[model samples]
Target: MINSIIKLAFGIEYDGTHYCGWQRQREANSVQEELERAIAKVANHVIDVVCAGRTDAGVHAIGQVIHFETKSERKDISWIRGVNSYLPADIVVRWVKVMPNAFHARFSAVSRSYRYIIYNHPYHRPAIFSSGMTYYDDFLDIDKMQRSAKCLLGENDFTSFRSSQCQSKSPKRYMMDLTVTRHGLYVIIDIQANSFVHRMVRNIVGSLIEVGCGHQPENWIGNILLRKDRQLAAGTAYAQGLYLMLVRYPLHYEVPQSSIEDFFLIPLLS
Candidate 1:
């Protein structure tokens, strides 16, 4: 097959609060649309990009991967500055580069890391604003949260945390690790897995929070996993506080960046 496609991969970051999600949509604001507009201005032509993952509305990403095809052969093109200048303050192109045509941004990825943030407080919420902040009075016991998250390793069916909108054909996946830590009033839960259902991470976080709050037994986490039913899981957390932290690809196909900034550096609550 003869192809004239120039595959350009980019690292992106966005607040996601002001947009619908990563996918393109009609009438609704989306990160995809905003990104395409900025990139078009930079490349001086039409370009459509596909992301490794499509986060929900109000979600955020510090380091997300996307790929697009263009015929322009200018490797020296100034897309970084040009695209950022046109993009709204909430979204940005951190880095961009040419990639092998065989690399699929989503499918080529090996794993993804995600995080959930909780404002645990007794009398107030948690102080987490760059401006005047409310709901700033809670505490999360990190040690307890960590202890409660230990049941989530190895391969298993994650039906308890799956979302109704999830399109995956199966609920089986591997969880590499899970960590619960606290920085001030922020309760951060980090989890890495081969893949995740739409609300799996959030639902797991909710259950962990419940365990920390003494609502459920420590062993209840295992029971939920064994239940294998979405309805039996804890409530899915809000999208506003979740983040698509990282996407790992083979080292050979990795994009070379001076400073490879990604979602791992992002604060859980931000």
Candidate 2:
């Protein structure tokens, strides 16, 4: 008798506050390391997972996706509950599904979405969920931020917004949508792209904040993009403010979509 290998995909969520990052590291704890260990315990063999996006340290993910191959057989419910039993509270396997071997967690993804939450009050700090959002004491001009964000829509070479350490072969990316909205004291920056270079979203947010704070004009964002100079852009924003919101795959794959309401307090955008 021969055992057949099976492929499974998982929807994962993690606080990402304590772990170093998603990838396994030699010296520190990582989200991938913890997850693999937990799944290994349940599978009775070593397991490796490939995530749709490898989020940096301190960045949270509510819609993370991953896939792995295994020879063991188990029901979807058993995979979820059994894996969670050995994992830390911060990391969780929210859903599981058996997938065709052709499906890939990262390569099959069509688009990735990210949300950055900012507390824009001057005096008081957010006592609740402080670790999940970034606080800026200075008042931000939401109108200015929104105007600057418009230039980011469509495909462009995002060299100005990419990190020096980025390993991507090209600086080009398709910006499907970019929006800045305000809900009470909270300001939200939502972005969707075909793919991103390292720290691209945070870097763009940093430059936009400069515009919102009056340090730079709204036109500055467009100028920065045209210049293609990293030094002309503002510093990268805090990782805590960032959240991996969604990953979309082709309809044939039947990958589940995640809801923003699961991790946010703001009203859903129309």
Candidate 3:
């Protein structure tokens, strides 16, 4: 007799400071590697997980989603505590649920959201959460950055903002929303999209910083989008400040959304 297959979805949170990235690597450590190992231990067999989105090295996530199939049946609490027991302190399984076969961690998603946090103080760099966020000493014009970011909304080819190493078949993505907000010394860039090419958010943030610092005019972003040339954009921003904040699935899936308040950095801005 064949055993029944069970599909499990997980909400993962991790600090990517010491890992190469989300994907497993041959040589370097990765969040995926650690997570798969932990989950396998609980399943009593090897299992692979598919994530909602892949994040780069030194990046972070508050609401990463993943799905895996297992024959071993266990309570939800068992999966969470068991897998977490084998995982490192920086990575944890926030929640787990039995998912329908039709639900896919990557494909079933409606949209994804990301937040980039910047420390804008000129005199001193934060020592406590130094590796968790980007430190930009230059004074930034919030109004200019806000105005420049508006051009990125809607569907468009983002070749100017994508990394050369990006392997996506197309450069076009539907930008659902993009906003720049400041709270005291913290500058936050929140963006939601149907999908993203590799390093697209960081590259856009770099260009916006140029506008915020008066190095690039407010219209430069629009011009670069028209040019569709990577050379016309600024260098990519640091990976530490970027977070995969949320992933939205259809209402029927009942996937839980991650809270931004769970992150330690949120209190500083609040």
Candidate 4:
């Protein structure tokens, strides 16, 4: 007889510095492997999870969403606490909910958001070392970065900003929003899009830095988009500064809103 299957969705937060990203890798440690191992101990069987986005190595996430099918007979809280008890200190399962069989972690997502944090300061702070914040000594002009960001606010071909190893079928994506702001010595770049090509956010931020530093004109971003040549854009930014902030879904899923707001670089807490 086929076991009764249940689909569960979980919100996870992790520091990606210690692992080789969210996807399972054969050669090195990965966040996926650790999560799967913990989940399997609770399920008493193999458990496979599909994430909303496969974040790259050293890229962190505060609102990562994932789903898995299981036949385990356990309470919802058991899945949360039991899994957490087995997981490493750097990774935690924030929330858990039963999802409809039709729901999916990746395909059901309507949009995904990311935040890039740059510590634009002359001296490095030991407190924030290797904590997913990129350090840059140059002063960044927030006004210029904001002006250049407007050119990417709608659906467009992002070939120039995509990674050479991108596996997406098309280069077109709809950018819902892009904002550049400063918090003390940090430069925060928050972006939301229907989807993204591999390393798209980092690539755009790298070029924006050039504009903010006055090395490139404010309109240079638009020109790069028009050219559709990856070679013409700025180099990809460091992965440590990137955080998969949120993944939006339709209301039917009822995913919880317990996002880790403290981790974001924007809006200093009052």
lDDT on C-alpha atoms for all candidate structures: 0.76, 0.92, 0.93, 0.90
Candidate 4 local lDDT, 19-127, one digit each (tens): 8888898998999999999999999999899999999999998999999999886888988999999999999998999899999999999999999988887766426
- Tell me the deviation in Å of residue 110 in model 2: 0.3
Clashes of each: 7, 0, 0, 0
TM-score list, all predictions: 0.88, 0.97, 0.97, 0.95
Among residues 3 or more apart in sequence or in different chains, the pairs in candidate 3 whose N, CA or C atoms overlap within 3 Å are none
Report the CA-based lDDT of candidate 4 relative to the real structure.
Answer: 0.90
1-113 per-residue lDDT for model 3 (tens digits):
77799999999999999999999999999999999999999999998999999999999999999999999999999999999999999999999999999999999998999
Q: Model 1 lDDT vs. the true structure?
A: 0.76
Candidate 3 residue 2 Cα shift, in angstroms, is 4.3
Name the best candidate (by lDDT): 3
Ranking by TM-score: 3, 2, 4, 1
- The ten-residue window of minimal lDDT in model 4 covers 261-270
* Candidate order by decreasing lDDT: 3, 2, 4, 1
- The positional error of residue 216 in candidate 3, measured at the CA in angstroms, is 0.6
Comparing candidate 1 with candidate 4, which one achieves the higher lDDT?
4
**Which parts of model 2 are misplaced by more than 4 Å?**
267-270
